[model samples]
Target: MNREKTYGIGELARDFDVTTRTIRFYEEAGLLSPAREGQQRVYTDADRVKLKLILRGKRLGFSLSESRDLIEMYDPESGNSRQLNALLSKIQERREQLNEQMREIELMQVELEEAEKRCLDAFDR
Candidate 1:
């Protein structure tokens, strides 16, 4: 018979390249809920997957609440329509925000270049 694997807090922290405190913070944030054995936290494969998803969401610039909502939409028994739609919405919003920031950056760059030209012209006098 084959048995499922479980991990200790340290093992998960190492595998994910995060500190134990980070894991604890996730737990406190209701993102993870590892089982307890005395004082030790025992993590299941589900927990590992959740942690991966959380990191992926963060890397994609998602807020913790957004990550939590996306995670919560997963249900093995149901369709993923809601999750996909929500994700698409978030992506669109992020793209808009990034576009606005890019425009601002371009304007700032133009102003800096003009300022440099003025400074150089003054120096030549």
Candidate 2:
């Protein structure tokens, strides 16, 4: 009999380098649904995969809702084309936002440099 490997909350937390509270928070947010074995939560491989994806999304600046939407869009039946397309769109949007922020930061840095120069010149006088 092939038994699927299960993970305890602590095991997942350790593997993901996240706190147990963070895992619980993801559960509360409906991002992960681990089964309860008496008092212990048992996570399946699917849950682990979801947790990994959630963390990856967070690192990529995706909001929880956006990640949730992307996760929900997964459908292996139709070759997952729709999900791939949606993810690509989201990636493009995030890239555009980051570019705009970079531009704004460059402007702010120039302004700060000018302000510092003026202060230094005033001090020199």
Highest-lDDT candidate: 2
Clashes of each: 0, 0
lDDT of 2 by residue, 1-125 (tens): 99999999999999999999999999999999999989999999999999999999999999999999999988999999998999999999999999999999999999999999999999999
> In model 2, which residue pairs have backbone atoms overlapping below 3 Å?
none
Worst lDDT 10-window in candidate 2: 66-75
Candidate 2: where are CA atoms >4 Å away? none
**Residue 104 in candidate 2 has what lDDT?**
100
lDDT per residue, candidate 1, 1-125, as tens digits? 88779999999999999999989999999999999999989999999999999998888899989999999998766678888889999989989999999999999999999999999999999
Cα-based lDDT for every prediction:
0.93, 0.96
